[model samples]
Target: MHPSKVELRVLGTSVTLQEHIRKRAEQDLGIKLRFVVQDGGSVQRDGVMHPDRYELYDQWFHSIDCLWPTHALQPIELSRIRRWDEVNALPRTGRLSKAQPAGGAGCVPADRLFVQADGTLARKPSERISMLPLTHNADSFVYLPDSMPASLVEGEESWAWLLAPELAGRVALQADAAIGAIDAALAVEASGLMRFRDIGNLEIEEIDGLIGTLIEFKRRGHFAGFWSSFAEAAQLMIANKVVIQSIWSPATVELERAGLKFRLARPREGYRAWFGGIGISRLAHGRVLDAAYEYLNWWLEGWAGATMARQGFYISNPKQSRAQMSDAEWAYWYDGARASAELPGPTSKHLVPVGQVRDGGGYVARMSRIAVWDSVMDEHNYLVRRWTEFMRS
Candidate 1:
C-alpha cells in the first residue's frame, strides 16, 4: 500500500456517501482512499477479528456494540475532530432544534458507547467516544404507486403490506439479517401474525418466532427474492417487477432514474431509523491514524454532508452542511418542503422534480417519530443463524 493511501472498509449502504467524500479528501488532504465495500455483516466480522486489515470502519452504530467488546476500534478523541463539540451536542440539541426522543433500541445503548481506562468499552461519556457520527436517516420500504391496488392506495401505508396476501410473490426484502430481520419483524407484527417484546432488541424467542415466520413466507413463495446491496434491491424491483420491498434512499433515486416510479412509504407505525458513523481500527497508528483523523474531519467539513443531504440523509452537523447547500436543497431535504426546482441526488443527478415534497415531512417530524432504530440485538448470534436458515429456505 502507498504511504499516502488509507484503506477503509465500509458497508455497501454507504457507498455513495463515501464516494462523495473520496475525491474531496484526496484533493484537499492529499490522502488516497481505498474503499472496501461490502455488506454490514461482513464489515462487522472483519472489524472485530481483523481490525488491522482496515484503517477505518464506516458502519451503523450497532457495529460499535459488536466490535467494542473485542477492542477492535480505537477510542476517537473528540478534541482531534474539527466538529467534535457539534457532534456531541446533536443528541442534546436535536438535529431540528427540538428535544429528540430519549432511549430506543435504535440508538447506541449508553452502556456500550464509551472507552474505559483499561482499553475496554463503557456506557458513559468522556473525552473520547466510540465513533464519529456521520450520516444518518430514517429508512422504510418503497412501492410503485401505480402497481398498488385501489384499496391499498386509498388506505394508509403499513409495514403489513410487505406480507399482505394481495401482494404475495411481488414483495422482496433486504438480505442482510441485522436490518432485514427488523423489517420482517415489523411486517409480522403489523400483520397480526406475532409481536415482539422489543423489536429493536429481540430476545432468543422473538428471534426464532420472526425467522420462523419468514421461513414460512419464503416457502410459500411470498417473496420475489432478497437483496444484499442497494443496487441489487433496485434490480429486484426492476427485473422481477417487484411492487414493494425495503429500500434505501439512494436505491430509490436509482429506480427513478431508470424510469420506474416509486413511492417511499411512510408507514403509520413509524420509520426504521438508523445512525451511521466512522470508527478507527484499533491497529491504526502514526501517519495512517493521522490520515484517519483527517478523513473523519473531512466528512464533517460540509461537502460530504451536503452531498448526502441530497439523498435524504441528515448530517450530524446540519449547520455546516446547510452552509454548503443552496437554500432550495436545504428546504427540500431538511425542511421537507416542496422542491422549488429540480433537485439532484447524491450523484448530482436530477431526481426530485419541481414541486415534489419529501415523503415523511421535515427532519424534526421524521426523527421525532422513529418507530425503531437499527440495532444489534442481544440475541444477535442466534438471530443471524436463524436468519441464514430462512434465506436458504
Candidate 2:
C-alpha cells in the first residue's frame, strides 16, 4: 500500500487496471493514490496505446495494465515483460488461490474454470486455470431442494422453457445495448404473446431492493422482470424467482443447481460471446512475449480446447470439443459434436450464427461472432450513460 501521505494521483482510462492495480498497490505498498481524474480521454486512441507517446507515461507511472474486452490483453505489456529473463526463469505459480467458503461453510470450487477460447489461459506458465473470484459472501449455504422433474428434462413439454407465466408482469431487466436484450423484448412484442407494463404503475407498500422489485411485481399480480449481473443473478435464482435468465455458461451452472429450470433462449439471435487470444505487446520489456506466444500456441494445439469444452464452454479449437468431451457434454454444447465436424466446415458450424438460428435437433443453435471494437475501454462511457438513462428515467 502507498504511504498514508504519498498523495498519489492515479488517472487511467482502464477500469480493470484501475481496480486490479490500485487494489494491488494498496495491499502491497500501503499507499492509496488520490485519484485526481479518470475519464475517456483523447489520449486513448482506438484503445491502443501509441508507443512513442505512451512510453513517457509508462515511465511516470509505476505500472500499467490493459486488456481488450471482447478478446484478451493486448501485446504491449507482453513485449515489455519478456525482457525480464529473471521473471521468466522464476518457477510458475499455480492458479490464483481459492477462497474458503464464507461463514465457515466449505466452498465448492466451480466445476469448470472459465478460460478464453483464444488461449489466454495457455499463455501463463502455470498449469491451473484462472477464475475471477466472487467478492460477495463466499460461504456455501444449504440451498433449496434440487428436485427437477424428469419432465423438465430433455423430452418434457416446456423442456426448453424461456419465461414462465408467473413472470409475466414482474421482471426488471438490467440490460446494456450490446447483448441485445432490448431486441429480444421487441421480438416478444412482435410475436404478440406478451405485453409489458412499466414498473411505476405497480402499487406496493415499499420497494427498496432488487428482491423487492421482484416481489412487488408478483404481489401486484405480475412476474417481476429485469436483467441481472452474473454474480447477483446466480444468488437470486438459487432463492427461486428467476424462471429463466439470459446467461452465459458459467452463470448457467449456478442457476441449474437451484433447480429453477432453464434452457437456451435465442442463441442464434446474434448475441455476443467473450473470446480471448494471447499476443505480444510492444510494451513487454523482455522475453515474456515469446513465452506468452508459446503458451498461446499450446492452447490452440488441442487438449486445452477439449478440456474447456467438457466444462460446457466452447473453444476455438473444434477438434478438442469433438474428441475430448463425453457424448452427454458434447450433446449439451453442440447437438451433434462428432457429426458437426463432418459438416463442410466444423468451426463455422459451432460459431454463434447471425440472424435466425434454426432448430438443430434439440439444441438452440446460434452463430458466434466476436465484436472487434474495444468496448471495454473506449465505449464504456457511452454505455454507462445510456444505461443510466434507461434505469434512472
Top model number, TM-score:
1
User: Candidate 1: TM-score?
Assistant: 0.93
lDDT winner among the candidates?
1
lDDT of 2 by residue, 1-393 (tens): 214433333223321123433454455444443332222332233224443222112110101112223222232232323222222110112112223111110011121122345544333332233322111110001112233334333332221123334335423333433332233333342334433342111112211222233333345644334443444546556656544444434344455444444444332222332322223233433333333333334444444455444324444345434665555445545553333322211122333222222122322232211111112322334433443444443
What stretches of model 1 exceed 4 Å from their correct place? Answer: 1-20, 88-100, 107-112, 116-123
Off by over 4 Å in 2: 1-169, 172-177, 180-229, 267-280, 336-364, 368-383
TM-score for all predictions?
Answer: 0.93, 0.41
lDDT of 1 by residue, 1-393 (tens): 464555444433454435656777678877777777767798899888888778888888777878888888888997898787666444433334436664345554344555667766555567777887777788899999898888898999999999988898999999889999989988999999997888988998888888888888888899998888888888988885699999888787778778887889899888888777888988888878888898889888888889888767887888888888889989999898999988887766688889988888988778776788888887789889999999888
* Model 1: pairs clashing at backbone N, Cα or C within 3 Å: 106-373
